[model samples]
Target: MNTYRKTFKFDAEFPFEYKYRDATSAQFELPNHVHDWYEFVYIYSGRGTFFIDHSFYDAEAGDIYLIPGNTIHHSYPVEDDPKRATAFYFSAAFVHDTSSVGEPFHYLQPFETAQSKQSFRFTVPEAYRNQIVDLIEQIHHEYSEEKVGYRQVIRMHIQHILLLLNRHAEETWGESLLRHQAAALPQWIEQTLSYIDSHLEEELGLAIFARNSAVTPAHFSRVFKRLTGMNVTEYVTAKRVMRAKEMLRLNDRNIAQIAEACGFGSIPHFHRKFKALTGMTPAQYKHSL
Candidate 1:
């Protein structure tokens, strides 16, 4: 498998979609939705909760969340005033899934599949509370200024949001740190993990990722296993075959095209792998879907 998604082209001259959310009192409401692309969300004031699949997280000011492709989530207010926040959404492949360098910034390793339906809260820091203000200011600046390179400038700010989380995630995760972010993802490794999700098409052999991450294959294997609680190969294979099922739901293309698009090497190979993963052929799965 190539382990890549054909990158999506954003409407660069303008924006596919752009908006800002701010509230002073307490207010939060979101219905469950599974985005086909990506979402970057940040909050400034008020307290609320985040619901991802099954988990419920306590949310507050200065919190940031990057919801990856094909994820189902919702939000509700802790109180009922005006909670402030800003969010951006676009195709997951809008950023780099892979390259000679590494995966794009947004592709974080998925929250555990078994754990997806659960919500976990994060801790917020007073210091980064100020930083979150700075980030949102810059994001709005790029959005408002619409400078010559504002498009790319927003992308850089988006990347900065994650980097800020990586740095302050633990300190701010006051109560929810362990339950949500976990030890496996420190900072850089967390980004590494997301790449695996974005690039599930390529062959995710341990050696390949180790080389990409600039870690020894053996060390990458051990560290990844220790952090994520799953070995490298297991994680990659599971995501690939499972995503194939969802792509099947669109039901516009034939099995071969679906197979290729989902990153399987060929139809026969995809068939074999599909049955192994789902205990049924792709045709059977399609009918069910």
Candidate 2:
């Protein structure tokens, strides 16, 4: 199957779920997928390679991965031993809804940091390992018991867990958080992404992009690739293709119009790149839709 984005709709009654799972290497393999809710995994015991976007981690027991929604990731074990882990899934709505009672930012720091260039996977410190494990176990107990106000209880426990993780992130990362934020990428990359979206119909040249970023072309290219996992040209091409796809479905514009609207100099170039990235021609995709 073509690797496509996967969006999950959380049940209204129970917007959070957690469980302990044990599986062999074969069963551990999952597709390249993205979800609409946050997923936290604690590898209790096992050895595996965890794939997150263009990055991979050599995972083992006590390692934790905090994957934000819409990030593509999966895992594969390296050995025949059963890989055991506990997974917690929760939605952004759940976090926001519960923040009224307590400070959600206290628990959301690590997750927010993950959005930046910081690493998402970390090994639990020996000092806090038991405390973290016990919290997971308590969540599991609450899930299994189905007691009164169990959902509320789970949310409360999740808030506590987030606080613990945020504290750990602060202690472990320290001042480096600021450094990473500063050094992660040129601030203009974010601005450029927005600018590109707003002006897809206008001329978008590497020189212009470099000028907007206030950096040399070569330096801009290097930092863009390092932080975005794609070079400037590739990033712009992807965005244009995404815009064309949306226009194809939402507008009555013909293919040629879409090509121009998406800033493609030629319809043929639009067709080629669109097919290369989406696995289908623009015409086919629109018809399929």
Candidate 3:
């Protein structure tokens, strides 16, 4: 078992990190894990599957994924197609302190309030995608070169990207989908996620989930898919895995106890799914922790 966990620290010396990778025709496998810093990934080309928390989305070019601190996730190439992406990682403290210096404070809203539905993926328009890519490239360059005032330039670019993305989201989905969400759908989704989180020990069947959403089973299925990009079973399984991870890391309970607490019916079933999702067994995960 490769039981080496990855961790990062953000101090005065280095407050952020950026990476630009052209993963063309390579199969990269990043196991499910959490990070201390907030992460933003922009897919510049190719396609794949992005698994985060309890949802999975079809990751393609022009899609951006926001993963707040300590969220377990992993995404990789789709067979031979490859997945190229630019990643930005920073701390919430960094954003807060930087924006406190006369800049807008609302830049952290999306990240701070990243509910289940808000945490996954956003597909940007082509024009906006190009602009975002350019900005990300510039940040990467500034970080690599460390020219005069590079840190300030990088901070400015980060704020610019956030503001632009906020505007794009407001114009694109906020007016329509968000307006509807504010009315009911968003609340419904939030409540549903909360219910799942709180009731992990119960038998969370389709009908029960549908009832929580205030819709028929069929309609609930459709709406949930449209909103979350994952079906009920997948979402439930992902949530179970996330909880199991937490237990493995924090509790001294045996594997079977953690499995039962996480809603896995049997130890074997739990072991299989845990390995499949996390690329490690419960024992290995605990050892890594």
Better of 1 and 3 by lDDT: 3
For each candidate, give its TM-score against the true structure. 0.49, 0.60, 0.60
Taking the tens digit of each residue's C-alpha lDDT, what string does model 2 give over 183-218? Answer: 333458767765876898898878999998888999
Clashing pairs counted in every model: 21, 0, 0
Weakest 10 consecutive residues of candidate 2 by summed lDDT: 176-185
Model 2 per-residue lDDT at 6: 48
Steric clash count of candidate 1 = 21
Q: Which segments of model 3 are wrong by more than 4 Å?
A: 1-5, 9-11, 24-27, 97-104, 113-119, 172-196, 201-289
Any idea how many clashes model 3 has?
A: 0
Model 1 weakest 10-residue run by lDDT: 106-115
For model 2 the TM-score comes to 0.60
Candidate 1, 1-289: lDDT as tens digits? 1112213345754333434875533222433444445666667677766644323456666566656554445565655545667777765344433643653333333222123523233344667556756876887887788889877776666556555555554344434332463342445466566676678676667877777788888888787654443467655655677578778876688888888777788888889877765667999978864
RMSD of each: 14.0, 8.9, 8.4
* Candidate 2 residue-wise lDDT at 181: 17
Q: Write the per-residue lDDT of candidate 3 for residues 134-248, one digit (tens) a residue.
A: 8988888898898999888888888778777777766765432111112234566667876888888779977997876777999888877655555788777767877888787
Q: State model 1's lDDT.
A: 0.58
